[model samples]
Target chain A: MDMTTPLVEMREISIAFGGIKAVDHASVDLHAGEVVGLLGHNGAGKSTLIKILSGAYRADAGEIRIAGEPVAISSPRDAKRHGIETIYQTLALADNVDAAANIFLGRELLTAWGTLDDSAMEAETRKVMGRLNPHFRRFKEPVKALSGGQRQSVAIARAIYFNARVLIMDEPTAALGPAETKQVADLILELKKQGIGIFLISHDLHDVFDLADRVSVMKNGKVVGSAHVRDVTQDEVLGMIISGKCPPGAVAGPGALRS
Target chain B: MTESVPAPATPSQDAKSFADHLRAIEFDARMIGMIAALAVIWLGFNWLSGGAFLTPRNLWNLSVQTASVAVMACGMVLVIVTRNIDLSVGSMLGFVGMVTGLVQAQLLPGLLGFEHPATWLLSILAAVALGGLIGLFQGALIAYLAIPSFIVTLGGLLVWRGGAWWVTQGQTIAPMDSRFRPLGGGIEGAIGTSASWAIGLVICALIVAGIAFARRRRKRYGFALRPLWAEIVLAALACGTVVGAVAIANSYALPAGVARRLVEAKGGTWPEGGLTIGHGLAVPVLLALAVGVAMSFLARRLRFGRYVFSIGGNPEAAQLSGVNTRKVLMLVYGLMGMLVGIAACISTARLNAATNSAGQLDELYVIAAAVIGGTSLAGGVGTIAGAMLGALVMQSLQSGMVLIGVDTPLQNIVVGIVLVLAVWLDGLYRKRLG
Candidate 1:
């Protein structure tokens, strides 16, 4: 891989449902150690576009390259195999199971006897959760009994546990309190320092400005524009999101206002 | 990230209730509630039947009667836990039993000679395979075709029942192979006194070892440990129950005539009082218990079981986690069908006959057992041991009513009311806990 090659390159992805386009020729790229904020209104195809990358949905047309190598991700399992992890907006934790079970939901630790190594998994869970949320003590209780912040921590712990190279966090702070939100922001910075690329999808511009290195705005199922976070002001990005108007410092996509 | 770590909060020592103490010991409130209910039912029935209900003979007979339903109930827990139901188990059992009977009686006799030892094993394997195939067929329709499980199983209920009748054109097949007859409990079916005691002792040893192993594992991980005294008490209680059950089974002696026949056949003279041959543990009861243990292991320790519960808890979440939800659902149904096959063998062997009406209304009883055991119909919760106990409870009620000479119609009405009442109470208990 070239030193300047992007860690992830999603080029011209499109998907439609029932003749209605959910994502239209959207493109985004993330460099190593960079955070790209995906900003859009609800149903702006931001989630749909990211879902294709996470293997939750297949694009009607697209090319996704990892470390400059083209790869096919048709399932969540496939995405995980390529070192991609996603913390869904809903958290997606299995409510009736405990933290350990949820953290190792698909990728479980097994004993030599081919049974679930629950104690080993629990110990690993404690180690990860200690780093993420040190006050967490209810290791035996189901996730349903946990508070929102605790559950969010569990989801975050799951995503980061397996050394993901490209992490996709959809509305990571939506359900969190201010303290928890700050903790997530810190975690993003911490992950970035480790040279991990992240796609942070959010409706909050302040969150985008605070954590993201670059910003990609989507509107009406199409990418409106892209720019460095330092180059584009919040109001200019807002204009790009609301009216598909590209700022002077941003590169306009096909969906940008034709003024 | 900040370097300073906050102190972990300690639980308050004061104001702990008895329930809180139980929780501290990690006792499942639902399991205790079911046990208490079982005790009440057993005591009440014994009183109503002038103590006949508590007799060794009656209890042993009850265990045998519960075997088939208990086996199916183990599978039902997984099905219901996955937010699906198998309404066709009873009919599938009937059809599978008919096929097994036909194989052993008409087909195996020609191929392997009459009363061949291997006939029983082959018949059982055939039944299980057939049952699994039927279950998979229904599961495929539900998972792949996008049909609701309720509709698919409802159709299966009719189809399998008609198929059962068609197998023998509504005729009853009887006089199963002598070797196969022992799968059901009879004088010949039991393991006898010495074996039961040996098995009981081994189980007690296992219980103690399991507790010790768990404690060591927990300590290794620095997880909170139950008080040492609590662990000892739990192990003692479990071991005591096993020993007591074995004693009860051992106390049920063979009838005088049968005892005399056995002694005479063995070239020994029968005494004036005649020899007492204890019934010990019946084969069917042992089979049911084995199924219970295996099912519990699968549900608690296997990846497949985890996926089933996860899907039940949240289908989309499980899917997003890379779980193959459809395959898991299909396998659950297939497992249920295989269990139904085992149940069919037991019921057929016990009756020494396979009838079209065999296992009729068994679906309701199996579902009731699972529900009464605390399996939620909405999904994501249940246990195999609880379902087995639930089967015992149901069997006790039916036999208790019979011993007290209650009319059949009245018995059905009472059972129906109890099922509804149990679920209502369970709902209330869950709400209170919440």
Candidate 2:
């Protein structure tokens, strides 16, 4: 239960549907204050593996440990209870509601009269966005009216607002511009400094190289390799993803990182 | 530890503020268009019919007539906003009205040997609850069983209308409890003429206060505010309508014959120097207002309402956010059911009877009203106030046609054409906005 133990230790995770393994024997560990980037091509089981830990899907085979204690995350509520939050690629926001409402969705702050304490939510949203994007100002407008980058700010704010220790962000900057992407990169670094463990899923190698301390590549429902960023090149990770074979020159490859 | 400083630059802030103002003006224009349409209908009919349409008596009658449909439209706004429909509402109304008739006129009176006001109140409650139950059942089937709401409610349309007929063997049930007459706009159910004027002024004042409060709140958050001219224009139009309608109503007194009967029945002197006016606001109108307020609160202020819009906008997103789609759906239908029950009770009470064909094809009218009020068929956009206006628009057309001696068949054709035109105009507006 101390900081020395891995914040999340997901081992040998496997999920199958109709006898087809979507994610097979996937293992990744995150420390108390580190960013681990999970990379793969489309349909490479990258999402399925993280979904098991986020409690959006179940793993037919695997064990998940938090602070060295095994835990079952049967639903999103369960995952939230364990302070594991996911920001899906779609952003998963109700477009008709304002940013404040979206950030506090499913976990609204109530007033003394028992209605939604919108002012409190708005104030907190202001604080979060002020840190993440100083130029963001559309608090009352629905998220649909906000730009893609601003919407990302809301989703990111929601994930971090509830004291999430382990964050799973899938393509957090996919729809963002270069400036917005840099803002998100900065936010990720800020989260890292706060001692949160983040499983960053992205197709952007540049982002992974810049933000992630450790990179894990997946191919065909299995991990290709896990290597520290300083020890391996982006092409080495790409080779593992495309060929399902670890680059021989990598510090941590299939044999060393396999569960 | 430092709080983020508000940007002090003016150029971008002013430009952004102006953009917000422009958007607000667009919204105000839409609302103003609705009011203008209402005026066109009112003045057109008034001019064509020699001012009869604009008379207070006719306006008062119109208000009560629009009450029931408007109340239901408030609920329908939610159902449609959730990307769902309830085609069974008309039949549900007939069925509930029939049951209510039995409870008030026969069942309770027969069982208890005498009807108390409390007993009548209980009957109304029972009828409303029955509506909720029926709605819940249909909603569960649609939400949990995964049947489409359109299909489920369409099936309910047949089942419930059939059930209504079976309840009384196709005979028209009559002689609703005397206490129920007020609910149908009877004299006893009305607010007096002076009180009506007072309420009318209060409502106008409330609208002004509400606008000011919202402006202050938005400003406090640094959001854009509408320009002063747009706000002034909208408020003036709204206040003028309210005050004008009440002034017209205050001008009308009871007809001489009705007044004589009232004088005879109450053994009271007819006031000198002025015509004795009838009661002002009807009970049904009050009921509809309550429904409107409560429904708007549910649709706008409550978490349940926010979820309804969210579910309508993106069901997958809502579900992924952990909203219980099935439960919210069920509750929405249940709320619609309760409103339908109130409508049923009003119609039966007004008519003093429930016929087998009571509320027949009323669903077409109700749905048409909701759509005309800007409840998008595509969902995720609507307002209770808009729906209320829609109901008023429909009722106005029907009443005006009847007054002008238009053929019933021709009236139907005209109304149908207007519904299509309204929707088409909505689409055009949406395109222009884009």
Give the winner by TM-score.
1
Estimate, for each residue in A1-259, the C-alpha lDDT of model 2 and write its tens digit. Answer: 1348898999999899899888888888999779999988898889998888988888898899998999998777788889999999999888877888888777777767666667677888989878777777778677887777778888888899899999999999898878778778888898899999999999999999999998888877877778888877877787777776666655443323343
Q: What is the interface RMSD of each candidate, in Å?
A: 3.8, 5.3
Provide TM-scores for the models. Answer: 0.98, 0.90
Which residue pairs collide in model 1, if any? none
lDDT by residue for model 1 over B1-434, one digit each (tens)?
Answer: 12222343446656667777888999888888989998998899899888999999999999999999999999999999989999999999999999999999999999989999899999899989998999998888888788999999999899999999999998999889887888889988988899999999998998999899999989998889999999999999999999999999999999889879988999999998667889899999999989998999999999998999999888888998999999999989999999999999999999999988889999999999999999999999888988998888888889899999999999999999999999999999888776
Q: Chain A TM-score of model 1 versus the true structure?
A: 0.98
Write model 1 residue lDDT over A1-259, tens digit each, in one string.
1269999999999999999999999999999899999998999999999999999999999899999999999999999999999999999988989999999999999999989999999999999999998888778888888888888989999999999999999999998778778999999999999999999999999999999999999999999999998888999999999999999989898789997
lDDT score for candidate 2 against the true structure: 0.83
Candidate 2 residue pairs that clash: none
Residue B64 in model 2: shift from native, Å?
Answer: 1.4
Which lDDT tens digits does candidate 2 get at residues B70-134?
88899899999999999999999999999988887788887776666666686689779999999
Candidate 2: chain B TM-score equals 0.90
- Which candidate comes out best when scored by lDDT? 1
